[model samples]
Target chain A: MNKMKELSVNHLLGIKYISEEDIQLIFETADHFKEVINRPIKKVPSLRDVTIANLFFENSTRTRLSFELAEKRLSADVVNFSAASSSVKKGETLVDTVNNILSMKVDLVVMRHPNPGAGIFLSKNVNASIVNAGDGAHEHPTQALLDAFSIREKLGDVAGKKVVIVGDILHSRVALSNIFALQKLGASVKVCGPLTLMPKHIAHLGVEVEPNLDRALAWCDVANMLRVQNERMDNSYFPSTREYVQQYGLNLERLQKLNKEITIMHPGPINRGVEITSDVADSNQAIILNQVENGVAIRMAVLYLLASKIKNYD
Target chain B: MSQKQLLNSSEMTVTLQRLACQLVENHTTFQNSVLIGLQPRGVALAERLVEILKNDYDLTDVEFGKLDITFYRDDFRRSGKVLEANTTEIPFVVDGKRVIFIDDVLYTGRSINSALTALQSFGRPLEVELLCLIDRRFSRHLPIQPDYVGKHVDVINEEKVKVNWSEDNKENSVILIDE
Candidate 1:
């Protein structure tokens, strides 16, 4: 693919606009980083003394912890701005809050917000490197990276592999990011759920929208189970969690109907029996935990590359 | 020598055998010391060492491990197209075990650096050492050193050090070619 292996990581700041070659490099690099997770110190001084700011505009646990741990592992000084009860609401704009943080010489900014395009808007005004943790279901690029790393780790290379993402496609920034990443990495991706959750016209996003769970599960090499947003269930995704499980809960018998080597993955805060069963989630074939571990490595890579690339500019 | 250039297949094999001999002299203390190869070529070196150790000292009990340092590299963003890495199949503990990290060539030692990070995810280690096939002295960007070196040569940074397997590259030596 004539991969530009020599380009500075500054070239990869925006995940949504990345090329096929850049996506390939992230996966390959994650493989290298994954090997080092077993080390005694569990760190390398790649981005030593660099400062990274985590400006989470939304409430989170897994995504925040993942980026924080990733920054620490890369040896960057992290400045966290938790807006749980803070000044994001006191009539201050995202640009104003971001500009105040930028004035303090933040090397990179990792931001999450309920507003779509907030990260892009902030990045346009700031000189500091920007990574979208989650931008109102528009794109959560790093989450997608971890998902790719997890899928590739468990089922070999997910390229050309059939990955069925079942549940909440409309509100899943994860689903959007995964569709982009999986397609770039050569996975044949499909989104399956009730018509309410599955958007009608998303072929433009390069994924097949399958309404039938049985057919989707039958062909999937990796079944990525996303949490159905109960908040977004205002219309109808199905009757209820019990009904959904009965039809698509991925029980042992349902799991057995597909490939024995098929892997079941979930980004956590998992609903115990709704989208996935207890036995199925904990199965030897499941790599839900691997996704968590890979999350740190991917964020570390993203931050290190971004911060270091910015270093050459100044 | 200033004129040292591309090494042929036989030169690579003989040099590797000499490296094996040197490893025996330096590590004669531990009968239980483990030899772990970083994936691809590192394990190839380890396999060669096992055959040599068996023939010379008739020692076959020396344990070997394979490390796939895919997730441990620092400059992961610049690494090439990703593929499913070969599995890291270490079945023993590294804590208190005399461990030797082996690879094909030593340049910046970043791969070894990543391997060190990866080893910790498994268990602890008493001591870690390295054995490399070639030392490209001019290209070092880190303060790391190989415990055992096969051959030291001065090389340009723009050049590629291509190490071929037993079947390819005609023989088993290190070949230097321009980028």
Candidate 2:
């Protein structure tokens, strides 16, 4: 009965598109899915007849595979589509490619694209339930959810906790999604990075801009170190990788001096020695692997819920 | 919604005693038998039975757990509203054990079918039985019947059966609600 009032939205396009209640519903649902996946028989027959298409216009190994595993665990039929090997190589538009895929009777679409608002555009034009995996520097909702889930599991709750998002904030979809999700869940968010890599007018989003990494680390309950997106940048955002590591990298020495047990998190493909040191990434305090494990459950909850709203399910 | 009382507090107490004695007569030791309550509403009935079986009948070895069938329901998407999932806390395995599925009311028999499907995750049981406080005998959509029924009820499609316990509030009663 409580779930009937929670999660008002069917499509999880972005954190900005969902309310605080919706986030709580997703987290609670994810808790159930997490327990289900831990069992010997991980498969749930909830979405047995539902068919899902994973559309990836950009490169992704972790997020793409995680969604597929989640779909399989829910007993949903899955089809994978990549833009590089598909008709997009022959100059087919995003709408044309997706519509053609939908003609095969796909009920849900999990899309990851290079352009911002690509998911929003497809959702407006397509009939299937749209889950935005990642859209340029816009949002990656599931990553942020798993990040929050890991934090909540470790520190007990997200409310009234301080989180510092460090690294390339301007080009990271992860940072944008994390800020929206954490703030909505009652956590105070701060972004710390090089001034050139930080977005202007970010304070308008109700986030504090802390240029000093030391102060940010000391003040936060959790330090979510985002990867330096080298592929997204056409030119150098900072002078060099050496300088970036020297200024913003989270290492053992700096962590020991913090005088508190701050949870260390990184959305992986870790740069190793750049945004965070290898020792810190592998330390007991790091919840990077837990984020990956929670990612499957989060996506499962998202898919299971959206599949429940499909009108044609038999 | 308007409701009509079916069983009062004293009558409900007598009914539970009868059901508990019936359980003891069927399974004496209860060493290899386990009790599972369907979540959301069935839990209270199962807990009462467990207490009576252990305290009065001295069958203390009986295992009890809660099984949530929210995900296994056939009408989840058809219900048009997302149903909240409850905890499924079957701590011990059910392999080769006599499993009794308990619920407050049995209506269409669809929930028992889903519970059977959900119970497969734990392990295959030697046998399975259904026990309900109120059994709507004529309204079953499937070829299923309860092994132990406290009261047999005849109701139309527009009516609902509600079983309230003293554990939840001050009174214990069964009411038939007209929708």
Candidate 3:
């Protein structure tokens, strides 16, 4: 297949909306941006003329910071807005907030909303490109991209590799996006968590559901341990954290049982002792920090590619 | 379309040797000098020159790296086509060292302009020089000229100059295509 110079889609709303070639192109572009970030001077002037607005309708630490850093490293003008501080508290609509931001001539919008498909709703009404940072439990496209990138860096490639995502799959936009991204890149995916934490129709997505953590760890080449997302739990999904950890927590002892080495990944704000113990989380096999590092590069690739498509009306 | 051969294999080989000798004469041992190849096209020229310097002139410690200027170009959003980036593998710092940028052809001098900006990300160099195999005369849009030139050819804007390397499974020759 021929190499792609630009992304097939203007906005990275979800991994499912993108083609396999688009993922490959993003990876290749991220490879260059990764090198650029490691240099003595970490900034590029490619997006100097473009302006971006980050609208976070929900709480986030890494995703927001990663996107902002990615924009700053590309020399793009950035303005951040969080729902807590914004007029949304005074009953400002999503379209109104975004429209007001776009009125200032913003070229792109990087948004994380509590509601699913918020990015899609804004893209249809707005006049700029939109990147879905995380929309409820629907998709966190950049997070998934970085996770897959981290996997590719650890192993030679993602294809033909087995990946098992452990923990609250039903409440994780990361899990949904990761499944689509991994599957697109030719990797087999499995979800391992309590039946309550797992989506009912998740099997329709073509991922095997492994309830036992031990079997899931032994069967996979990489284990992406997800956060327990305590805030998203309106009702208790499991009996207790202790029970969940006893059954699902990946600790040092559990890691030693595996015959061959498997790469460990966590899109962070990791529960230190819940889904993964501190010993295993901080282990040599875990690429949690690398995933954070690759997040910037991956986001930069996304912003740069999308910004390139923002037409100059003048 | 029609094409005209600018330099054949024997002529190209002699030109390369002369260029290597000139580089060795100025930067002996190449200890404090680093060679940077502009990505995609310039890399082939830089690799060939480094090989000749190592084998024929016995300059074994020559430092070489590739730099991609796609991110530093001025025409980022101005152009319709998105610029594709190539590999950049600069392992050593360029601070306080004489750096030479090698490319296959110097046309509008825009690529060199972009290369200059891209190089600053590494470190500040003591001095910088441009070296190209073919210098397209009277067509430069920028006020830039190469310090070293293998051949100077007068060509119009519509025509193109292509340097074919034997490494790409083609005969080593420079062809000027008339479209």
Question: What is candidate 2's lDDT per residue for A193-279, written digit by digit as tens?
Answer: 999988888999999999999999999999999998888778778999999999999999999988998999998999999999989
What is the C-alpha lDDT profile of model 3 across A1-314, one tens digit per residue? 11338889999999999999999989999999999999999999899999999998898899999999999999999999999997999998889889999999999999999999999998999899999999999999999999999999999999999999999999999999999999999999999999999998998999999999999999999999999999999998999999999999999999999998889999989889899999888889999999999999999999999999888843
Residue-level lDDT tens digits of model 2 in B30-74: 888889999978999999999889889888878999988877888
What stretches of model 1 exceed 4 Å from their correct place? A1-15, A233-262, A312-314, B1-22, B29-51, B63-94, B97-179
Superposed on the true chain A, the predicted chain A of model 2 yields a TM-score of 0.98
Best by TM-score: 3
A1-314: candidate 1 lDDT, tens digit per residue: 11234223443334567776766656666665665565555765556657788888888999999889888877778889988777877878878888898888777888888888887777678777788888886788888888888877776787889999998888988898889888888889988887777766678878888878888888888889999788756676578778787866777888676665678899887988888889999989889988899988787666655554564332
Report the lDDT tens digits of candidate 1 across residue range B82-175.
2234557787777788899999889888888888877877677888998888888867777789888888878788776766678443566677
Q: Candidates ranked by DockQ, best first? A: 3, 2, 1
Measured against the true two-chain complex, the DockQ scores of the candidates, in the order shown, are 0.16, 0.50, 0.57
What lDDT score belongs to each candidate, Candidate 1 first?
0.76, 0.90, 0.93
Candidate 3 Cα outliers beyond 4 Å, as residue runs? A1-4, B168-170
Report the Cα lDDT for residue A254, model 3: 92
Candidate 1 chain B minimal-lDDT segment of 10 residues: B76-85
